[model samples]
Target: MITGEIKSQIDRIWDVIWSGGMSNPLEVVEQLTYLLFIKRLDDQQTTALERATLLDEPLVDNPFRLGKDELGRDYDDLRWSRLKNMHPEEAFDVVANRVFPYIREMRGDESTYAQHMKDARLTIPSASLLSRVIDLLDAVPMDNLDTKGDVYEYLLSEISSAGKNGQFRTPRHIIQLMVEMLAPEPGDTIVDPASGTCGFLVAATEYMRAHHADAINSGKWREHFHRQMFHGFDFDNTMLRIGSMNMLLHGVEQPDVRYRDSLAESNTGDADAYSMVLANPPFAGSLDYENTAKDLQRIVKTKKTELLFVALFLRLLKPGGRAAVIVPDGVLFGSSKAHKELRRTLVEDHKLDAVVKLPSGVFKPYAGVSTAILFFTKTNSGGTEKVWFYEVTADGMSLDDKRTPLLSDEKLGALAVLTDEEHGKNNLPDVLKRWQSRNSTEKDRERTDQSFCAPKADIAAQDYDLSLNRYKEIVHEEIEHRSPTEILDELDQLEKEIADGMAELRAMLLGGAE
Candidate 1:
């Protein structure tokens, strides 16, 4: 967790940047990404230097050397460590003129973060503001993985709360809930096609580090975790930079985060490549069929971005590879042939694991559209026996524009430790627990409960409509009905009282007139 003081510092920097004429939140984050990445690189090199000296070994590489560049500034001055100690004007000059340009060349031709950084430009307006930000950022420690990653994550959350760029961020708690449900293994190769900010991929790295620490600690798995495990695609250049920085801060050395228009890009070379996919693609929108990928169209012909993304997932996943993705509610029960065919494919050809309904307010302040998480495995032959269903009412936060937390921080998210009473405020913890037991106890649960299973045959009977209400049995409150005789008697009494009151009123009026 990032401390309150750290959050304040970040917010202050953001306000400074916002007032500095960098109005776009995404642009602010991108600018911040450049500086943070530079700082992180210097910090890593410093750690390596200390370790090597302590072990009496030669330095592997020196990112900076004492030499003058063509611009006549010492190469060392471009580093965060050196720039932090310089005068404000000097620091600003170095950052704007040299440091920003130098970062693109830090990593070789093949580095994703570097590839994204090729377009880096310093948008911080003034010397004093940049200095103030550096001073404030310097105060916050970024030594440990958690603190460093949390710092960036907090900044992203602020961007979300700031409104314009909230569309780029998924609520971290919701991301955590989805990650906990998937429980990514160390060996899993995960991808998020519409990878804005790469929240799912970052959460998966955290999950692997937490649950499969032993396997990941091994050199082979560590290499895989760093290089091959996490992949993300996005067409927006700003998002690619932000997502790369996000993964890098989270300790993923080299994630496959690059530019790709997921829906439009052909997947012929990468078909059936990934073992896991997790995403929350754009919702309730359509794309032009002319630009849509032919292969995705072959899966299920649709222009809806939501349905096309699902088809993209199906195309990308290797046989038996699993996925957990968010789709709008329309995809759940839409009567269109494309929607029905995709649902049928999941039920008839592949294994549809579960459908978890998220609250409409989950994406609020940006979108209030209802959405649900679809968990399924790609199998050529049908294997879906019964699909688990969960109705998530409260996600520990209010279902409103503000999305205020209803409970303390500890009582939130899927891994939250909450009492039974607290569970009502946050269903994610219960959702995770029930999901773990989905094959066993979850199947036998009654339809009226919050979560249960629907047999494959039953789903087929409903034309593959996967809406929760289609299978969910509402336990309406029982009310006692009045007998017909009693009702008529009450009506007669009312009529007699009306007549008596009217007669009394008429007599009083007549006496007054007389």
Candidate 2:
């Protein structure tokens, strides 16, 4: 099903170019969305017509009532038949103005209210582009379940294109890793405050499917799916709309994706609204400090994205609800008023589950900031029992010239070390060995000397700076057992090569001047 959908999507894209239209992939996708909605509405109307005919009744519930009239003011001048053969620009204009307006009216009906189609959200492209897109998308049967996912997936990918907005969308692979580490349960409500394209929610759903397939299939999952399993929020209306479709494409219809900035402190009422929250929030972004200061002061008391989101996540979760979030590395060690309060709250007030340091290039092609994964649980006891930290400098991937993900290697390494059960005083030698090697004594986990673990006692000594590097030791590579003469020879050759290069550059410059 996924394969066919992908093929159809490719075909649609090809047709747009063949029909004499120029558009980037992202622009083309925006146009595809407008058409897909119309086609789906048409399909719904057709189904209604069939059912009404069989039951000997009128199609009273057909909200769009697409075929009932010749045309409405909404469709510019293009109708289905007219659009198919017209010039690309003419067709596009008709669809953008005429068709979109009608679809907007139909979709906005209170009865059909949904996060994805909450009226028209697309920044409709030019008529020529819209025409080509419509022609392209029309090539596929938009109502086909398989094709729909493919088209939506394509759009989701396009949304991640450079300069669109925000960081490039979080990759699905990384999202899956976060969900697996957090291990959301059956009845647990999963939320992503900065959901962007809903990558985390989709991953959480997949996690549920794999771990609780039997429970999900018995229709028991409906309760969880509708009310518990997923919640997402974002400030960008476009992102919210895109996120809605992303969830729907993955079978999460009627998703609870609210359109609001989760990092803003003014929205505290909406915080503390979920159980499990996973997010890759908008990075390097700041909120209104003066306005949010009152609410924020209660948490970190400083207006920073990392601190605000931490407070937001804590407020959102029910007591004992877990969260795994990604934040800039500076948040882990930066000396700021908010940073201090953020650490105090996590290590002292909440249980710090684990801190996994990530390489700087994970967000390459968009954001180059080094990052860390903070896995924490809101505890009933109001104090941390134990905390684990992994200072992963190299996940088997070079953080140099080329930024490639070594998922298989890094994931396997992390899985081997991260135990699901408590690591405190376990008779488990393998887990103990891994932990001990990665960290010194448990006290080292909290100490201010190493890059990884230190106990509560050590943490208290540092006034509870929860920076992983404060405790985890940076182990230097072992020096090779080579003679001093051999090392000197190597350095001498390197120096000679540098001198030769300089001499050549000097000669070239002198010749050019002459």
Candidate 3:
């Protein structure tokens, strides 16, 4: 049930955001995040204290550490109870003074708020607004990580409307699909260079736990998972902070998510990089070559998402490292010089494993751009091998014909079908049926009939136009096959009907003349 309390609280929060002078939704979310984290921390400490006292634990080691004043009133450093005493605007100012200092100090030279602090003010709504928000948050239980995750996810979804700061967050289901396909092993180092809200990081963590539950529960998980495996980087400080908080909420302690413009050479050199890079890099944004060239390669490799990120990921990945990335459809078939060069590099220099073409409406609510997923491995020079291609015809559903929630559909599962002994031979008939129908040649020439297997020669011949639509020919079923006589009979019946209608019209005209 959509509880009234939750909806009302959400509305109030929205009202506050609109009422406040904050222009950016992401910025508004940032302010809310700061407040929420402080409140939740205090709540947890309070609960921890209660639990400890109930169990008769030692009083010397209080996790909360709430300070006390001379009048017997608790003067906890930054708890909501103490802040509640001040006016909302004043309270937010105080919070900014205390909490932000800690954050900036922790972030050192790389803090996003560091420069903004010069002119930063905590001006917000009135005390009443703050109090109501606090009351609303109080209703939420802060004991479990999943609960916190649910709240965070909702907030991200709410603020993910398009054309907001050039940020269109990737859908969670798509993130889940990538993580599941990659199958990040427990303790495997995972990184997202363009970590928007850390969706990939969170999904990767969940994927590991779900796949290797026993190992995760055995308590050695943290030792393996922490600084060793999970990593991320982004140019946006605001995004980095959100990503860090999100990783923390998802039980990832000390997430190494950082802020770095990866395309620049100097920034790339200064940054501590990663092994497996999974990212949907920002596209359509013009690159400042004068600045970015210090970190990014100067040679005009490609203008599209895949080429830019491919270069970056290749540089980021160690030898034999794998990369799965989301790219625009243009990268698959664009005839630009950079595009051809990048494709040649992938075929001749690296292992291009698979390409999955997603439906155009995948990002409906946020964006209507058609996209594709490219999975590849970083290797030395290699021959042209078979690359599996899957086209997702339906991407969930929508009631109002906008972006709808991601739902599981059996028909769309043909994209990730397995052929080898590892995934079992029996599990591939439906997919193979379509694949073979498209290409009947023993040499596997690229067929425009169905989504068929293509030979290297044919791909080279076509200049490597990898658009699935070009190859996956739609086969329309014959509608009620009829013999020549039956077709003639139907045409004769239709002719008689037309003749009778004409005769009635003529009769009416003659009556009028009479």
Candidate 4:
């Protein structure tokens, strides 16, 4: 959804940073995100001042402090609004020596964005580059929420489009499909354990704003939405800052995007805490048994990071809490005991809702590993009867490295209005529609169809292999039949023609001899 104007603005920032010799796209975004956060802080401070005055209260938690700092520069000068117009050297002086430390020492604020800024640094490389980035950032209007989101998304897209660190970028439409399927509610507690750039959290917020405008705008739910609704974990400090800023731009004031190695850390404190989980954790990874979390190890003894993430999701979900997670196809049909046991636990211990097969090309140009989405609810006892399965062959884009869109903006996502022919090119809309019919019509569909349901007993009989290919039936082309009378008439006419030709040849030979 990043348009040309926003794209160009971000592109200009990227160029400035690259010219300064910072080649890592994530770092470029990280530096830009920090400045954007500072600008946002100034705006937030203004709002706080007005509200405190209106309530006849003293301003207490301003991002800027009173009077002078250790360097004798006024604390006000450290703000983006004031320092942005200063001379390049002075601006760099404040940002490098003053602003960076100010944010780094911003430890008292309980907001999640502040939590991640504890180790923040200003790595914009040079004063001129910093100023150019600021001018570019200031020119693009962030006043509109939609434009703000578009800008952040474009900044993140540059990381993927750069072709080096694209593993961090999930296809935007895929994130939308997951969000739409989850349908976030006002009070729902959401978490993404491996939240690279927090795309899932951003999408969930957009969906909530679009679908539940009345409730989301109300004061009670609004407080929950801003303060406590979303959480994300990432070990990389740079990613944590970028992801938190992404949520902030999308209007969530304080998302819990903090530092934690999801697989290495214990889930004891957060066990059964969240109401819903949405994630696509890093996969095809192995961990030492000693390094893995004990609680997760207890879920199903394994070193596979993918399986451990699934265990973490199970522990994170409150009873009756649901999750929709993307996993490598190996998780579906791995022959390992851990894999079989995990699939069994989902079907027998809780409720396994669906397994959606994605095309192998879905993650192309970064990773070609085949993946699938698993939907389940955390129940103490078994509730799964029939588990739905869907195969998404195309996601409105070329299934290659280019990943070019095959449809216009309006015809791209899960809610797109696409015809049958168009649906062949993009299966997301159909996936969404058929997901709703999983219990009813999907159950009646033949295995040869794109989607169908399988009974729990059937799954157990096959050792709980959830791969769609295991259950999907291939459609065979029907054969054309011929009648015996038509075949016999053609054969008889062919025999008579052969006899007449033979007689003429024999007569000609005898005449020639005479």
Candidate 5:
């Protein structure tokens, strides 16, 4: 967790940028990301030097070179530590003229971060503003991996309130829950088709490191972790840049974070390749059939982005590959042919593991679309016996725009020790617990429970409708009412009591008068 002091420091930097004429929040974050990237490069070079000294070996690869570039400017001046100490105007000139060009020309091993720096421009407007921002950034503690990740996440969360292109940052806790449920292994190939800042991929990496540390330390697993384990696709260059930086900061050395429209015909490669996928794809939009991928259309003939993404997932996953993806509630029981067909394909053809219905406000202050997480495995043949359905009412947060945390730190993650009452307020912990035992204990739970298993045959009978409400039996409380004669008797008794009281009052008044 980032301390309050760190968040305040970040906010101060943001204020300086805002007052410096970069009013767009996304632009502000992008510019800040560039500076941070430069700082991180210096830090990496310093660490390399330290390691070389300790081992008494020559440094094979230093991110910085101590020489002049073709423009005859000293490359050493572009280093963050050197630039930070220079006068504001000289520092700005070096960053604008030298550093930006140097980063743009960086190739091969540095291509992941360099690729996005091609169009990098310094728009801070004034030398003093740039200097102030750089100095504040210098004060932030990025030595600890957790602190750096948390600080970047805090910066990303700012974009959520801005609301650009239906993109909202998935709550960190929600991402953690999905990653925990998936339980990605060391060598598992994971992909997020709509990778926004690559939160899903980062969370998966963290989970693996936390649980399978020994496996990650092995040579084979280490090779996979550094290069081949994670893949993400996004069409927006800004998102690509941010996502790639996010991976690098989280210790993923060479994640495939690149630009590709996942739903377009151009995305033909990587079909049936990955072992796991975790995503919260955009929905409620339409696309032209001519532009939609032909392969996805063959699976589900529709232009609705929501349905297309489902088809895209099916096309992307290798046989026996598992996925946990978020979809709008309409995909669950829509009457359209494409909707019904996709749901049927999952239940009849693949292993539809579970459908976790989320609260509508989960995406709030941006959208209130009711959504559900679909857990399934690609079998290319029938494997679904019983589908687990869980209705998540609260996810350790209030179901409102504020989204206040409802649980204490002790009951936060997968290993959360929550009592029944706590589980009632936030059902995520229970959802995971029940999902792990879906085939055993969950199979016998009644339809009236919060989570229960609905047999495949029952689902087929309903035309493969996967909505929890379709099979969930509501246990209406039985009400007892008095009969008409009993009601009349009660009325008569009340009338008699009223008459007796009236007579006693009259008698008392008459006796007093006599």
Candidate 6:
């Protein structure tokens, strides 16, 4: 979690960007990400230099070469530490002319990060605004991975409104819940098909480091952690850039964060290629049949982006690969053939492990569409015996536009120490606990409970409808009411008492008059 002071600093930088004529929230964040990336390069170079000096060893590879560029400007001046001390005009000139191009030209061993920076542009409009933003960003503590990741996430949160293509950031707690439930292993290959800012991948990486620290430290696992374990795909260049930077700051050195429209292309080359998948793809968009991917259409013949994404998940996962992804509630019980076929595919064709229904207001102030998380495995044959269903009411935050935190910092996420009574206010921790025991205690739970399992036969009887309400029995409390005669008796008694009081009042008035 970012401190309030750090959040305020980020907000101030946002204000500067907006005042400088970059009113689009996405553009503001994109620009900030670029600057932060530049700053990170400088920080890395400085650390490398310090380590080399301490060991009295020469540097092996310097990202910052000590030389002038073809434009006759000193490359050393473009370093963040040196540029911050220059006059506003000189700072602006160097950044716009030198630093932007330098970063655009930077290449990693795999060149994924530099590939997305091909269109990098300096859009801060004025020298003063640029200078002020630099000062603000420089004050932020990006020395540690936790703080840096938090700061970047704080900045990403500013793009609260939905984008043109129905893209919006999934709530971090929601992402955490999915990642925790998935419990990514260090050796597992993970992918988020709609990797907006790579939140899912980042959360998975954090979970691995926290739980499987020893596995990550080994040479084999360490190599995977830095290079091949994480992959994300996004069509938007801006999102790709931001998502790539997000992974880098979180310490994934060479994540395959590249640009690809997951639903538009054939999956023949990469089908069944990943061990795990996690995503919350865009919902409710329609695509032309001719323009849609033929392979996805073959899996589920529909242009609905939601259904296509579900099919895409199946295609992307190898047999025995598991996935936890969010889908709109309509996918649960829609009357359309495509919807039914997809649900049937999960239940009868593969292992549909669980369906977690989220509250409608969870995506409030941007979308009020009810959604659910589908946990399933690609078995290429039926394995779903009993499907667990959990209805998540509160996720440690108010399900409103503001999404204010409902608990203190210490009592959040999987480690929340709330009592049973307090747990009612946040269902995340309970969800995790129950999920672990789904095969045992959850199997016998009644339909009226918050979470219960429904047999696959029952689901098939309903034509493969996965909506919790379809099978969840509501235990309506009986309301007792008074009989009409009893109510009349009480009214009659009150009326007689009122009349006696009236008579006594009249007698007293008459005696006084006499």
List, residue by residue over 272-327, the lDDT tens digit for candidate 5.
Answer: 99999899988667899888899999889998888998888888899999999999
lDDT of 4 at 450: 89
Select the stronger candidate by TM-score from 2 and 4: 4
Error of 6 at 85 (Å): 2.4
Worst 10 residues of 1 by lDDT: 160-169
- Please provide TM-scores, in order, for all candidate models, with all chains considered together: 0.86, 0.65, 0.72, 0.80, 0.86, 0.87
lDDT string for model 4 (140-226, tens) is 666643343344445554454433322445677888898898888888999998887788898899899999877777757988887
Q: Give lDDT per model, in order.
A: 0.82, 0.62, 0.61, 0.82, 0.83, 0.83
lDDT per residue as tens, model 3, 167-202: 566655567667766778775778887886787888
Which ten residues in a row are the worst by lDDT in model 6?
144-153
Best by lDDT: 6
Using TM-score as the measure, which candidate wins? 6
Number of colliding residue pairs in each model: 0, 24, 7, 0, 0, 0
Candidate 1 structure quality by residue, lDDT tens digits, 198-274 = 88898898889889887877756988998999999988787788788778777787899998988874645688999
Worst lDDT window (10 residues) for model 5?
A: 144-153
What C-alpha lDDT, on a 0 to 100 scale, does residue 175 get in candidate 2?
Answer: 61
Q: How do the candidates rank by TM-score, highest first?
A: 6, 1, 5, 4, 3, 2
**What is the TM-score (0 to 1) of candidate 2?**
0.65
The Cα error of candidate 5 at residue 34, in Å, is: 1.6
Q: Which residue segments of model 4 deviate by more than 4 Å?
A: 1-12, 23-26, 38-87, 90-108, 135-167, 480-514
For model 2 the local lDDT of residue 423 reads 25
Q: Residue 258 of candidate 3: its Cα lDDT?
A: 74
Candidate 1 TM-score, C-alpha based: 0.86
